[model samples]
Target: MTIIQFPTAPALNASEPHDLLLETLRAATNQLSQAGKALVQCDSEPAARVEAASHLVSAGQSIVAALNAYQRGLQHASDQAAG
Candidate 1:
């Protein structure tokens, strides 16, 4: 079975919200990758594989919501600052 890995980030401080989101997404991707690998490895009674797949789906959905909220928040903050 292949070992899945996370996405690499360029050198950046983690204090920024965008950076934090990117890091979060990278982690999610890594998790999804590992889950996929787990599915491939199982090939039998798929309970573990199904659970891992569920994890991937949940993480992906959460990431999408968080990122969207972050973007909207940033835009609102920007507009407030400008005004």
Candidate 2:
């Protein structure tokens, strides 16, 4: 019999769950912001410009998802605490 093993991600040392989630959302927002600015300022070829634009769109979508998920998580936790 072969024993199966899975690798575990490193544990975080965040003092608060909300803080960690908020930080993740903030970082995602920052990434989108920088990508937008880069798209505006970058004077590269048309292909490169399109690539940057695509990256901005992707990052923005990811940020929205992150925020939505974080909000839902907060609501669930809050409800659990209240009840």
Candidate 3:
């Protein structure tokens, strides 16, 4: 029998989650912008163009949702720290 050991991720500190989320938000925004540009440059059929646009819109919606969640998490953390 062969035994394999995998390295485990280090535990996150208190502020890491917020930082990580912010980083993710930034990446998502960049991706959304790139997607928008691609949609604009796309010269495919009307249906295909519409589908690309729809995907860009969906990415925008995801960014909005993530921002909202991040804000709520920060507020909750602040409240907890204050009390």
Task: Tell me, by TM-score, which candidate is best.
Answer: 1
Rate residue 12 of model 1 by lDDT: 42
lDDT of 3: 0.60
Between prediction 1 and prediction 2, the one with superior TM-score is 1
Report how far off residue 83 is in candidate 2 (Å): 3.3
Q: How does candidate 1 fare on TM-score?
A: 0.69
TM-score, per-candidate, Cα-based = 0.69, 0.59, 0.61
List, residue by residue over 1-83, the lDDT tens digit for candidate 3. 21222122233233644775666566566666666665666665565566556666766676677678778888888999999
Q: Candidate 2: which stretches are off by over 4 Å? A: 1-17
The candidate that achieves the highest lDDT relative to the unseen native structure: 1
| Cα lDDT of model 1 by residue, 1-82, tens digit | 3333434334445665687678778776776787777777767745666666777786688589659867976898799899
Quote the lDDT for 78 in model 1: 94
